[model samples]
Target chain A: MNKINILDKVKSNVTNFFQPKGVFDKNFVKKPLIMYLIFGLLLLAIPFLQEQGYIQFYTMGVFGMIIIYTIVALGLNLLLGYSGLISLGTAGFIGFGAYGLPFFSNLLGLNFTGALIVTLLLSALIGALIGLFSLKVEGVYLAIATLFVGEIFLEIFRNVEWFTNGFSGVKFHYPHVILLFFQLRITVTSFILLVLSALIVIALGYIGFKKYKNKQKSKIEKKENRITKIKSRLLSIFKIALIILGLMLVLQIVLGEPLLTFVQSGNSITTTGFRGYLKLEEFDRNQTFRFISLILIASMFIIYNIVNSRTGRALMAMSRSEHAAQSMGISLMKYRLVAFITATVFATLAGTLYVSWFTSAYPDSWTLGFSLILIAVVVVGGYKSIFGMFLGALIIHGIPTFYLKEAFADINGLPFIFTGVLIIVVILFYPYGAIYLRHDIKRLYRYLKSKIIKFIHLIKQRIQKSNDSEVNEDE
Target chain B: MNKNTILEVKNLSMYFGGLKAVDDLSFEVFEKEIVGLIGPNGAGKTTVFNCITQFYKEDKGEIWFKNKDDEEINLNDIKVTKVINHGLVRTFQNIELVPDLSIIDNILIGAHNQFKSGILEHILTLPRARREEKELREKAHHVLEFLKLHYIKDMYVAGQPYGVLKKIEIARALMANPKMIILDEPAAGLNDVETDELAGLIRHIRDEFDITVILVEHDMGFVMDVCDRICAISFGKFLAMDTAEEIIKNKAVQEAYLGGDDFE
Candidate 1:
């Protein structure tokens, strides 16, 4: 009787444990902010961990590239996912940025900041021009137009030997970091810290502001007295300011030295009748990883915020029905321009970063194949999800170039075959992208778990019966 | 034109190749009135609506609209997107709500023009943008409440019942705060009960929102019941424009619907 009681108790305990509580619950595991922070911290530790010989430099480099691709994917996601614009000229914008950076730095003799600003402006102008075409054409025709534009850009890069150096490409000295009257050479670590710290500040500020607003709204809902409302608002503002200040202090402690050094350095030089002193930074692979990761995080946050905004809603509506969207007072041309410009700027930034990382800009690299891969990344990642696109980039670009090249070195076309198969599988099973795979996996796990529990219960019943028989025999 | 006339179409004609989808069709929509465009299948009721809204540019004729600012503007001179800015908006015959977006988000799209903040403000989540967004959300909630669709505020439009989807579409149009709304076949797929509910809702929208409603519906019962004025058409030509009772008794409308002596 005791044995039977024990078996029942065990079975009930197992069932109780699996009854959708604690970690088993979806809400508990789906805290986006917590997950993001953890992921961010992990990314921060990667460079240090690599330096300690825990991870190889090659691996870090590949990871860094993956982070860059994630930024590109996020940018593309803004267009493809939110705006419903399928662009095949992503490579063209990237090439323009890549080539434009060198042009600005070498010919215009501008610093990194100036070069980036100029490149972005030029890319926006070009993007706007391309956006105009979207007004006239859409879907497959727009795709073709973008493709043609990309090819034109490639041709310009290849033929303009004076600027792009033709097939040979243009190689220029790294742009210096200039501040006030000081110039300091930048290391990869400092650059990473600089970018990451800025992103952290923006993200935290935005989130903090949002939380404060929600609190204030709730307070208003409670019908708090006006005086009390004012007092609480001031108090909340003070608290937020203090928190932001504290965060800044912490970042300063971590990254203050590099910034100080950058400001204090008095490295001077004169070039071609120009007298300007600037910091020259040597960017290494690890810094590349850190920088790209920073960009990825920042872009992800921005895109997330945008999608939740009115502009995002308009773009989504436009995608579903142009006629309906127009009826809603959405200016199709304006929103399309915004989406196109944003995508172009992001691609341009990625291109500029790529050139800096490799210390070379290649026309051949920015081809139709590159653009197609980006499209595949957005599609396979689940066109609507930012994080999904990140994974999509890793799968589509990172895996083929890093892992497959190493694993199947003898197999000339293995990467292509593998990517095709993977894309097909993802499309077939998770048409939404791998982001939705979590739900499917959870469902599968639940089914298997229930079956296992039943099997265990059946075994326990058998054991209890056997024990009872033995007791009966002894008696 | 009457002092309250919000829209006037003069000899509006649209042609697809040699086929004239809408030819020499003219009508006027007055303030706070429900006008029905009734026609048989292939009579170009939708085409006429499209021409009025400038979805398809008429090869001939003028669309004159009295905008919210009290300016009489030629709608034909402007693009389709600008028509809504003039306080004129429309709903599709087939419901066109963004399937993936929540009902609130879908309605929020209609508030795009009302947003005071620009792209930069939205991207940075500036105070003004947040304030605008909050106000829009409140307005959307109010609309949903008014339409009795607050239950489905968070629900996606995908696979929703035809009645609910039609209501959502109208809800979206209402969110635009338009002076006039053009609903194409608002009760197309609804049953008798649903159609009656829709007719009541359409009247409520016109009265409560203080907007002119132009609807193209095939259901004679629905049209007669809801419409203040009925415009009957056949083969892209205006048959008659009169009160619902007068339209029901019109000989040309009867012939158009029941066939002429040639058929007998």
Candidate 2:
């Protein structure tokens, strides 16, 4: 009885210590904005830590690759997850961006931004062309069509000497910021600060919007005087102004010095015609890591918001039942085009980032196997989830390239073997991917918690009975 | 050209190779009326619905619908997706709700055409898109409440009971705010009690929403209990069209149901 009592006391103390604070506890973590902020800070700090010798450069590079692939996976998720359209031609679109970036920058004498825009537009056009052909086919046929398209792109890249530099590939300088007559290099610290600040601003905007929505809901319930209405409106305006001011302050902190230096150092405003006053400058490994991380974070938020909106619902409906979606007046062609274009654009963006990081575009880099791996990422990550895609990318791309490659140095094909095994396991047990693991874990915890509580109750009852017997014996 | 007629199907015909699925069939449905298209299995009832909705291109037909704006639009020429824009929507025989989605989300998909915002607005979650979403959500909730499905609004459609799925299909059709709703075999797999409940719900929906209903059902009792008028067909050929009482008394309909053994 004494042992049981002691055990019960210990358990109660542990439970009390872990009890939620009702607000800003487990519930706060449940909020996506908080999770984004936490992840954003961690991603921003990793590269800096690596440069300071706290982490390896190779590990940082792998992290950078993971960020790049996450953006691609998110874009693919918009297609495969919501729209239910499978494209094995993701690598082809990536190639378009990779090659297009350097081709425009080096040959056409366009700046980085111009090259990026042109590449994105070109990818969209190609995606639409593919989507047009896809309209006539579905399921396995569509998959096969995309596979061939991917091969065709590879062939073009390998054979086109004048445009893609043939199999030799095209090498170019990294992207840079050129203002007026002077070039401004974005240092690693400033880049990290910029990304972290942007993420913070987005998180702040999301929280502010949520608070405003809640306030409006409460105000709707209460009848207000004219003065109160005016006061509330003024308060909302002030809040908006405050958010804008916060954004400007963060931006200034990151880019203020660079802009000041460029302005003071430059007097010549040369006419560059179509290319503008921008130039491409070489960036070190850490700077590239920061840039890719920034792009990944921004893309994650955008894709997350889109998937939660009305457009997402329609796309999902179309994916589930084309007949029903059509009955609801969701134009199959329009939504399909939208999905294809968005996905291709995202792949192109990732490719552009990749070329900027590596300072080279190679036809052999993007292969059929690479495209299949991307699809695997979406499948193992959990369909229709932005964060799941990130997790999937880490597990599939990050773990293999960084962790497993080092751990299993003798095994030449260990990553491929691991990916195949993981895919099979995910398909068999958790077909919904790693995201569904969260639900299963929660259910398990609930079951265990109930059992523990029941056991505690039984122990308490037994102890009470022993006490009663002892009292009776004494009497 | 009748002012009361909401849908006028003129010489509709659909064929597959040598087989005539719908053989020059014509029918008229009036405004705010419950009409039933009754036939035996494989009697081309669903084909007619498909042709009217332009899911299958009719080899020859003219389906003119008087929209909410009182404009007579030819549905045959318009695309399948545009059919709902004229205030005409349909439910499937197999219950085509998005299986993985919550009941409310499935209904919101039904309100897709009603959204005024474009892709940009939806992606950005702009004010217009947010307002439209809230309005549609409230509308979906109201429809669920009316159908007494408010409790299961958050539940996914997968593995749901047949009766609930049928009701959800009706609820989805209602979300379009249609002037007319076409239900294909709504009571196909439902029990007697559920069929009776469906009959009552159909009447309630028609009365409350002030909309017309056209159901293709095999259950004779359900058809008699709910429909004001009945159109009977057999072997892709029209048999009879009259009030429910007259349809029950018609010899041709009885022959179509009892004597039709050639249907495949």
Candidate 3:
């Protein structure tokens, strides 16, 4: 009973961790909690892992790329998974952002936020145009039409050098409007742990004081226990002092940057953080990666909420049976347009963020192959699942770009072949995507557990029988 | 009895290239009445249903339905989606609930138009969005309870018993707060016991929901047992409109069904 209670408490806390209370709805965080925790821990520990030489430093840049693609895939899933519409023009829409941002900010003299807004609007307009031409047709036609749209954008990128700068590529520089990144001598893991404990301590202190004030105060008043009162006051002061100390340490770590002087003069203090030497540029790149990870979480939060709402239901219904959805008052034209625009906007947003990290846009990057790969990412992850898209992006892009590239450096184009084969096999076996791997793993574990229990029972019985025989022999 | 015309169909006609599916048909349904549209296989019964619901654009016709706001509006003038705004909703000949969605989620979809929150607000999960979602969820639960299918609320609509799927469709229609609902082949694949249970369920919907019911079904026994009136059409032409007993006795309806009244 006590164990069950502890488990229940843990489950509730995990669920409440993403509740976004006062901001999000009560049940907004009804996602796979274990996946969230795993991702959360990985993201926080990644910088530290690299700093500690457990991971390659360049992997940060690769993770950023995977995150950008994942955002785009999540948007596409809204179209493909729920609405049953396919848009192969994801790369083209994203190019508009990469090119449009530079054009707006540099050439058009717009602020960064203004440029982003303009980019979103421009993408939406093009998205609507493509949707208008193709959406009237049935399923396969939409795919063919969007493929053409993608080709058209590529041509525009090549010819319209005035906007995209053609094969030369367009450069962008973001001044970091969010103010999120900071370099510290302290490892990220230790810093995060400190912050978490500090928060828990403060929360506990507040709760205990509230309880004492409400119930214990009256008891103390009746007893007239001056000693108890003074002790309680002293405890409150101590709590306040502890909070101040935690804050001071946090400030020192973030700002002052003197953590037992493990800097090693110029060594990265740890080797895996940079290539041979520590540079501010490398730190910025790592921060960009971290910033994009924050973006991944936000996008997931938004998509998860929307996918569980009325609009999502309508889209799913429309995909399954148009006549039923129509009779139920879900407008096909409205919802289809919404899905198309939403998908393109997300692609564009990913592109803009891509520019922030890469600081440049190349026409070669947003080609037909990239668009196909984006589709593969969404499918291989999970079609209608938000969490699956992230996992999909990681496996589809992260593995090939980070690990496979090194593992098969001797063979040219080997990683691409590996990715293609993996996608085919995964789709063949798990048509629902690799997200259902959890279910399979859980089943396997349970089977093993039961078998182990049975084996133990048999062994116990054998030992008991031997003991009985030995006792009879002694008699 | 005061006959309140909740829906009035006038000179409704539809065509399929050269084939006249529904040549010209007319019917009227009173509020809180259970009406059945029945005929032979090629009698254009479903075509008339499609026309009234605006699933197919009629060559010529007027479909005036009394909305929840107590206003008679022409469904022909209204778009297909806006027909539900006038508190007019429908089911399909085959069960059309989304297979992947849970039974309760499938039903909550009928309340799509009831959602006033914007997509952005929903994405953010704002308080208004939360409030609206909570309200609609409660409504869905209440509807599930009414149909006594609350136990299977979390189960997927796919692989459900045929009888349960049929009830789920009706339950979804109820979630719309509709003034009138049209069910197509509500008893298409039910056993005798299920058919009997469906009749009771239909009666309960009519009495409890205080809405008119119009269904296209070939289950004559179920229709005759439940419907307040029966409208018979043969080859896109109206044959008869009366109570079940009168419709059965009418020679035209019998001729339309049994082919020149040659009874065994």
Report lDDT (Cα) of residue A326, candidate 3: 91
Encode model 3's per-residue lDDT on B106-175: one tens digit a residue: 9999999989999977875665687788678777877898899988899998899899999999999999
lDDT of 2 by residue, A282-349 (tens): 55666667667777877877787777676788889889889988888988888888889889999999
Candidate 1, residue B92: CA error in Å?
0.9
Write candidate 1's Cα lDDT for A1-475 as tens digits: 5445444444443333333332445664566544555577788789999999997777777776677677777888889988889899899888888888988877776566667778899999998988887999988999998999999999999998887889888775443432232334577887998999977776675665455445655554333244334544665577566666545434433442222222342444334222222344644566656665666676777788778888788888888888888877778889899889889988998888777666787789989999988888888888788779778877887777777787888989998788788889988998888788878889999999999999999999999999999999999
Ranking by DockQ: 2, 1, 3
- Across B1-264, the per-residue lDDT of candidate 1 in tens digits comes to 569888899998888999988889888888888899988889998888888788787899998889989889999898887788888899998788889999898888888888889876666566568768867887788899898998879988887888989888888888887999998988889999999899888888878878999998878788889999999888899899999878767889889977753322
Q: Could you estimate the TM-score for every candidate? A: 0.81, 0.83, 0.83
Q: Each prediction's Cα lDDT score? A: 0.79, 0.81, 0.81
Of 1 and 2, which scores higher on DockQ?
2
Residue B7's lDDT within candidate 1 is: 88
Tell how far residue A55 is off in model 1, in angstroms.
Answer: 1.6
True contacts kept of each: 0.83, 0.73, 0.91
TM-score of chain B only, all predictions?
A: 0.95, 0.95, 0.96
